[model samples]
Target: MNEQETGERDPGSGERVHWSEDGAERSALWRSESGARPPGKLAVADDRMTADAAYKLACEGTALLWRGDYHGARQLLAALARRVDRKPPKEGATPEESFHLYRQARFRRARVLGMLLVPLQISHEGTHSAYSVPLRRAPEVAQACEEAYGPPGEELTLVSLRELQGVLGAHEWRRKGVPVEALGGDRVHPRHGVFSPVRGEYVGLVARAPLPPGEPGSLVAFDIGTGTGVLAAVLARRGVGRVVATDLGERAPACARENVRGLGVQDVVEVVSADLFPGTADLFPRTEAGADAARADLIVCNPPWLPAKATSVLEQAVYDPGSRMLRGFLDGLAGRLTPHGEGWLILSDLAEHLGLRSREELLGWIDGAGLCVAGRLDARPEHPRATDSSAPLHAARAAETTSLWRLAATG
Candidate 1:
């Protein structure tokens, strides 16, 4: 895939960022995983730059190319964060309004903090990709950068320090992996730009949900939008013999496949790159007599909960724009299920609490899709943010309940 399709910015692409230093114009390949446009104004900063001055420049939309010690840069970033947090967005009258305002505030904060930039010097040597931060006291980030951005071409890349820190954190998470209780304590390693299965409530619900009537080794299951393949692996471990896990775009499929293989379920789970159902042809092909093969006995999906626009690649895991994935899953569910099959839609009521979507609308969609709710399994979120009053939309989050809706086709 090309850079645009894969969400990977080409360092050698036309998105070059230029700045002035020592009476010469210096330019480097600009990279942003969030797809943010390069800053229109540029300034060179070093150890002598104060946090206040830097914050002012950033607020005025000037990107700072750091030429200071790495630790000091981190300190300045933290200082800027403190300043940003000192002033909070004004709460709106309604829950939905408040949620939108909160998102706006976050966007502004990210934009300002993202202004702190760093230069990454890189080279490609046959099979080895060498990279480093060209600043004093900079940590060894070659492996992290390589893992997140892929092997670099022979170009100096300019990236935001905020994004680089995220890359480093994602690398660590990918290396150590997150422990999923539903997977018998096995871990799921998420790559950069892929959503991590840190929220275990949904996984637990899937692990405990009742499977369709069949022998453990005889059932076929489909996991839609399998982010890190955690749910797919859970189903495989639960003895659903044949599991087809489908995901869209580049990172998710690759990440899910890696996790599935690492968890030793590659033999049972097939990871495919498709929007949702994989058009059904991949799982069932035409036979000699042109007979239709049996559909999946179980189909599970955990789409993004919020019906709002996502500003970055990471937010796609949290925001669902217009509930497109949810509605699409429901609309196509019945046609892809066996007569006695169950479609488990794992979702949260946070949107309802935030007034972004109504519970009535959800049920209506289910009915309109020629399906009915057979049963439902509910779990309260155990994530710390659920109880953190300081978090955005705390009231909505505190009352959130994640449910696994067991659905079946209506005759």
Candidate 2:
């Protein structure tokens, strides 16, 4: 029999065919059983396709069926990334202007790769390729795909080619761990969907800040919106008696718990499910020993610094719609902080420079909320974007500085 005749058939309607010759050129064909020609044909060739060709096809709305080895597809993707990175800088752009552009590029990349992703239909019968994806890490990638897309049925399982790459990258990062010098040369492995503390300036600022002087038996701290629990772990290591870390994302709570346990700070840090401070306020009663209850000695919040709408759940960490989290944090700060205690607000001034939020307006909100800025420590951002002149927000990002603002309630 010819190669096409021996190929596997789709179990669902038997209308699709997965053809591969020498395990290199794989393609998917949707056909009618009555001998009618296939409607959709995606074939992967042996030669590497140029990014310009791929991108043009992507923009013109065509999918490149990758036939190269799984690893080769990855290399081609990297080449595409380099091309994307080399795009010319926007002239006279503000930081916000640049940020928008950066976000747009990312969004566009996702859109293009999403178009390339072919749907797969898996069953207990075993693996069947629909649109061929050169997945090197098949088991893990398949499992993750299942988790996100649900159990594969006879129907095709839809996934983004670009997002699959991102998931795989995240998996690797989680396995290897991100080096955190503040943890004494240790590393922190961030779980999927949790914010990773790659930008160390903010975490370092929190690490070096002054802790409230109190009875040293068990200092209590609340790490609001603890992403990877890095900040909470830092506080715990700094001799905080107990650190209560809270996050609304189910993934974040679990991620924080795992990291806290890995760091050996589980004894001092407790992970809880919470949307904000109110969720934890129940732990503190209105009357304790017939006196007004005391609040946490330290409340630290590192809200999303940008002022924008998130396109997806994952983007929530980077983009805060209408500055809701920032404003909510400031509004909630005074009530959660105990007398003589400080609320450390770690933030970036990129929004201010972008004309999204004015520095004067933020300060006004602080003062309006009956709080005083006890002290402010600033650190220059060291991320790659700061040095990339071709980036959209080069001017604003180049001038951007992150700050740890200590606020005390003054009612």
Best by lDDT: 1
RMSD of 1: 4.4
Candidate 1, residue 127: CA error in Å?
A: 6.7
lDDT, candidate 1, 1-411, per-residue tens = 000111223454758776667777677888889989888778888889999999998898888889889999999999999998887657546898898888888899999999999999975668876888989999889988888887777888889999999999999999999999998888899999888889899999999999999997988899999989999999999999989999998889999999989999999999989888755454654212343433688999999999998888888989998999999999989877877889999999999999989999999999999999999999999999999998888899999999999999996
Which run of 10 residues does model 1 get worst, by summed lDDT? Answer: 1-10
Off by over 4 Å in 1: 1-12, 89-92, 123-127, 280-282, 285-294
Question: Global lDDT of each model?
Answer: 0.88, 0.70
